[model samples]
Target: MKQNLWINGESVETENYRPLLNPYTGGQIAEVAEAAKEDVIRAIDSAAEAARGMAEMDAHKRADILRKVADYIQEDREECARLIAEESSKPLKAARAEVDRTVMTYTFASEEARRIQGDTIPMDAAPGGEGRIAYTVKEPLGVIAAITPFNFPMNLVAHKVGPAIAAGNTVVLKPASQTPLSAYKIASYFHRAGLPAGALNVVTGSGKNVGDALIADDRVKKVTFTGSPAVGKYIRENAGLKRVTLELGSNSALIVDEGTDLSKVMPRIVTGAFSNQGQVCISIQRIYVYETIAEDFVSQFVEEAGRLKVGDPLDEETDVAAMISAEDVERAQSWISDAVGNGAELVLGGESEQQVLKPTVLLNAKPTDKISCEEIFAPVVHINTFMDFDEAITEVNESQFGLQAGVYTNDLQKAFRAASNLHVGGVMINDIPTFRVDHMPYGGVKQSGTGREGIKYAVEEMTELKLVSFKLD
Candidate 1:
């Protein structure tokens, strides 16, 4: 299949291309454009010109386009999901859900675009300011550079691109090098849905090269990125004066409090940790089980984890597919080995079992170790017991990377305190950290990077407040 890069609403193909590998088979899946430096400049120039004129476009026009984008996504649902699964190695079931999320994000952003209201000051009503009126209106931050990660390619693209476009800002997306095909298709779909030629552009190339070129360009007015903390900081330093929204890194921790039924909690935890091969930013990495029920929870979790089917993603019976590649599996195995070498117990599956890591579970794991501290981005959970709720919350919040977290507790007070004390973005009261419904404030605290995603919050972030003060003459 031929893959065309989308730029300025055109299906442009570069003379040069690079190989795309099938993670399950370790073979070339497709070839993508090694976009020329000149083409990159044209894309930047086009998006910048779009941004220049967008401030004058009516909000209703932008909303209408986003509505069209949503309709197109649903109309081409199956094909989009298939492409997502094929290119990103996401399980067929999971890929279908991602398509649904993509649709939801666009739809929500469309509705929210019409509701991007600003604040009105009461100066005119006040005695001393009878003739004066002051109010604030949100304006687009000009050109936005959307850099999405490999996992949930289409959905993340929707989260960034939908809000940027709905807020009347032109976008240039630099999708993950490993999984740009799905994103390229999204950009195409948006263009066909009647987005202006220069309003949205998609480029596929090296993270260090294309990403740097986009960030360093003065014309790009905003940068929205989702990646590792190391790269996020690098972008922040290099991207000067532009508005930045960084969604980076997550060693998401979950606390299973006492009094919750093990049967109910274990399955959710396993599915949350293993779904999408644990490539999700909010995937469960560390489990701080209450000491009272720690052993029982571990046993129940292990039993459930054993039943997860690890094999081909397209098969209806397959529960877990391959991890992006054999190399990622090896890296996960090495981390487990290093952890086990330091006395961590390998409970269920271990080593590279031909791209399927078999849902490994560790017991008595260390927090300082890579399995717990680092963003493994794999379906592996580290086990650790905590004495009480305070200790549990403390241990879970210790990591520098705080994205989303979960706690299973019947106590409302405990849940509320956990929400307040947990050093993360969103807290799940009775569910796993992986839970996301496409419209909540979705970003992280600390090394997990700055800024908020989700339709409404992202629209708010995509906009700039312009305070207009006027006096009646």
Candidate 2:
């Protein structure tokens, strides 16, 4: 199979193509077009030229286009899920869920298009503004450059592109190199839905070649990216006053209070840690349990983690699949070994077979250990016990990244305290930090990156606010 770039509502074949391999089976899936810096510039030019047309489009027309894309996605749901699983190694079931989320994201963008209005200002509040009438209006930010990650390629792309289109902004999308096919598929859907010729353009290549070009181009007005903190920081530094929204790294932690029922929360904890091979930005990497129930919870977690079937992502029954690359597996193994060397006990499953690093667990790891402090994007989690509730909150806040944290507590006071003092973007009570819907304001403070995603908030981010005032005679 061949996957080409989508520019100006057309397929663009390049002389140089990179073969995309299935991480699970190590089989060739497709040869994806390798976008050069020149190609990326062309894509940007296309989007820049289309911005005026998109801005002139009626909001109802934009809403109808978004809805049609969602309808088409629903019609071909299984094929889209297969493409995501094949390209990114996400399990089929989880890939299907991602497709559902993408559909909902577009659906929400459609709804938000009609509701994108600003508020009227009370000009009379000021001493000299007695006879003035003022209001504000939302306007599109022209061209948006969307850089998505490989973990949830389809849904994450929808999160950026859907809202941008809803706000009547043209987009220049650079999907993750490993998962460009999904982006092209989505672009095709938009074209079929009657989007204007140059409204959406996709260029695929390395971040250095394609992403840097997109970020440097002044024609691209806003850049929204989802990836590591290092790259996010680089974009922020070089974005040159252009609006940027970054959803970066996270070592998300969860606390299990003393009174919580282990049986009820055990499955969620397991899923939160090992889902997508722990590639998810919000996947729980650390767990702090109350001292009284630490041992019981750890034992239950280990048993449950061991039961997860590690195999091909395409397999219907497979619970875990291959990591994106062998290097990722080796890096995770080294971290596990280093943690064990640093007095952390490797309780269960610390070995790697092929590309799949079996879900590993550590007990009593110090906060200073790499697995505990760093954003280890792998299927490994460290468990620690806390004597006091306040100590657990403090421990969870010790890291530089603060995307989201979860606390499972029966006591209302503890839950409220956790919600207030967690020092993260969001605090989940009685649920995992990995819990997120398509419409919630999602982003982090500190090193987790600035600005929020989720459709409505993203629409606001992709637009500019202009004030309008008139003097009454």
| lDDT computed for candidate 2 | 0.93
TM-score of candidate 2 against the unseen true structure? 0.99
Q: Looking at candidate 2, what is the lDDT of residue 22?
A: 89
Candidate 1 residue-wise lDDT, 108-218, digit = tens: 988887888889898857678888889999988888899998888899999999889888899888898888888877777777777788888888888766888898899
Steric clash pairs (candidate 2): none
Worst 10 residues of 1 by lDDT: 349-358
Per-model lDDT: 0.85, 0.93
The estimated TM-scores of all candidates read 0.96, 0.99
- Please count the clashing residue pairs in each candidate, in the order shown: 0, 0
Ten contiguous residues minimizing lDDT sum, candidate 2: 348-357
RMSD of 1: 1.6
